[model samples]
Target: MTPVPPSRADRSSPGEVLRAGPLEIHATARQAFVNGARITLGSRAFDLLLMLAEAAGRVVSHDEIQARVWPNRHVSETNLRVQVSTLRRALGEARHVVSTVPDRGYAFTPFGQHAPEPDDAPVPGDHVVHVVDDEADMRDALEGLLMASGWRVRTYGSVGAFQEALTAQTAGCLILDVSLPGENGLELQRRLLALGLSLPIVFLSGRSNIPIAVEAMKAGAIEFLTKPAAGEDILAAVARAMALALSERPQSPA
Candidate 1:
């Protein structure tokens, strides 16, 4: 298998191997092990485990896991639950390393930290993602990818729809088409800023010249990705944007 490049989304070198307690984590090769026994992990499962290990003793919110593991993909929690269950079973009682925080999210305790005192906090809503694209295929593909990686995705086929969605719900990040049906993406971004919403925006299109990319960046796009970008790259940008949004939010974990 090809090694996934290192990104903040993935917490390892391109082909580095990791040994933590009885478990071994080889992020480059996408493999895991416990006590010299090989543990089978799918790409998604490996990504989740890597996120937990990176946190390594802190409780990783559901949104954080979704952003890091799935990136620009959108998926329902059912899939996430199945994968987590499988991982927990594979790890068995060794899963003390991966602790569920009631309605909040999962935490990685590593092998050393003692169990944390219970904290009663409200379980936040599912992570929110916004996709603005006039092309149905592209929108659906991106939404499907995000869902598979684990997030709640909303799609807008027009600027009006995008604006309505923005006002109706909260979004961790925005995936915007550079050319919209009514107004250009740069214009839309200006409007977003005018409204005082600093949501992270990512631009995508089939026409991403250096000039256009530079203009979009100046208009506040965190990244300008071409249409049909690699899944990993798209995810990396999305994860970075989400982390930024999460940091900006004032919600304190109870």
Candidate 2:
């Protein structure tokens, strides 16, 4: 039998499988696996990861991200960061594999990992609460309290569903979960801004971490209530959100 030439066996292609820490990336296949389990990564993110991994260890500048990710079209750095955030969340335990250099571009550095957990509690009674939480028990608990207080409520488990609701009827306010399965709260907030939906947002978090709360407020949330907050506190937040929403609504021709 004839042996294959060294050139044929030594070449690497973009289709070759690449590894960054625990992640197994197949650029050609347009997919990735973590610890042997398939994980979801958006198309833009998939391309972003390929570019970063191809860098080996050198930082890829913001200009490079734009050229590669949005070539021939302009995109804001925020848009780029949103994709990075999604990529980081998808990376989960190995999120540190990607690094963000201060005042510089991101780089491919497979040197870290991360973890996750969940919690519970209740708050808020309102007009169309529009809860976007995947956790049913928590959603039900909030529903019970809000209904008991004579407040209307609507619940959704995904951003797509909530967006559908937004199209159907404007809500008084949105009670958003920071840890939604996809897009999450912050990402949703940005999307809402892009869509010109200024509906007041009230954030709910079980952890109630200060930094998280600060971020929520910074994103224009009417209030940031930790889980297990008093029924009255929830109602108070609802009132604030509703009032703000009402004020923002356009007046009918008189």
Candidate 3:
């Protein structure tokens, strides 16, 4: 494991401001400016910039970046890369200030600059969505829909497969079908609760099973939809689930 750096609050005063060429970062206010004009940056992008800027000339490893920007979430390298690209775009001409160190991580070179872009910045997705359904067609369809709507999606054909892939740090929403060959969706939900994993879930059933739906909702499922659910409805449910997941993330220390 890469050694974790000191918290940002530990190294800087509340109102401290950092400068990199023409860019200015207001730490307390969590805002950035370029040439005296404010720029639009997403929360994650801003966090990434702050971490890199504070570290300045040091190479902040991928692990450190993920720990600071995502806190407890288990995010892929692609997520970090995307945020870096976002930060670079926000920085405009000064984008070269943020450089990727080969096989290591990223660094904020205040003096030097480079022009290597991140490889094929994956679809502009914010979070991963894990889909578990026994039907191959359903899994593929959901994956396509979610990916098209800017979500990183992974599909599994069985509960076992999903469980095998899951870890304590897995951070995302789950779209699970209620029926399976064994260890059904409801059982998996119960097991997850017992294991203390609070991953927000959206339940899908081929038939409208009111009792199962009630059970799932009672157990804290974000949404329970019966197929053939409309595409819009599924997307809406996923959005809600993603929101819930975001809300449940542990906040970083101030």
Candidate 4:
């Protein structure tokens, strides 16, 4: 990867600010302030906005956006456009900083004045990580690992527990064990997809082999890890999955 050049929004520099309610976003952190409350952005959106802000006052091509946002597998340009559109709507009509670059790509052009506070609390959109494993020890371990890595972790021992939790809170990524007491992990994944609940999925299978992993991946698993996997590998895969999930999450109106 090439080194990122210094920008006006750098830690030491001052750039145009974006204010949503009480949220004041500096170049760093991409923090959102609402009614004196701080809102956290998911990792992927934070990185994406930072890259766009750093390229403020200039046009960033679609290829550049894809290279920065998704460094993994190839993604379509439409995906990048959708994300940009979502970001714009989230920013509301206060000022349209993100502008289209016609056929080439997009550019940042700040407009409009900051508005007064709205009456309602801003709906939170932080990335959440969910773990589902039958073993108590493994469930606790994964939760601890994900929390230490700065993710909001939720754990479940069975599919019933997971389903109940999903009713309360949505997750950005799912770490699922293939074999569960009630519904198998793969079966659960299939169900989630059928119900239109699509999040990045990582499968952990004691029986994970070429065929099993391939089947899981074909069934929409992002990555499959066999039992006795190293912690770092799991963390990396989770991070990647979280990033993908963040960009894919359905956005509410601004």
State, as a TM-score between 0 and 1, how close model 2 is to the true structure.
0.48
The predicted structure with the larger lDDT, 2 or 4, is 2
Worst 10 residues of 1 by lDDT: 1-10
Runs with alpha carbons beyond 4 Å of true place in candidate 2: 1-127
User: lDDT tens digits, residues 1-254, model 3?
Assistant: 23232223332446767776677788888888778798888888888888887885678899998788888888766555545644665687666567765446887766334323234333224357999999999999999999899888999999999999889888889999999999999999999999998788888888877567767877887667778866765775677677667667777699
Deviation from native of the Cα of residue 237 in model 2, angstroms = 0.5
In the range 201-242, model 2's lDDT, one tens digit per residue, is 877777757666666666777666666655655665676566
lDDT of 3: 0.76
Off by over 4 Å in 4: 1-126
Instruction: Give TM per candidate.
Output: 0.51, 0.48, 0.51, 0.51
Tens digits of lDDT, candidate 4, 113-175: 211111323223556778999999999889888889777888889988989867424758899
Query: CA lDDT, every prediction?
Result: 0.69, 0.69, 0.76, 0.64
Worst 10 residues of 4 by lDDT: 114-123
Candidate 1, residue 182: Cα displacement in angstroms equals 0.9
Candidate 3 local Cα displacement, residue 225, angstroms: 0.7
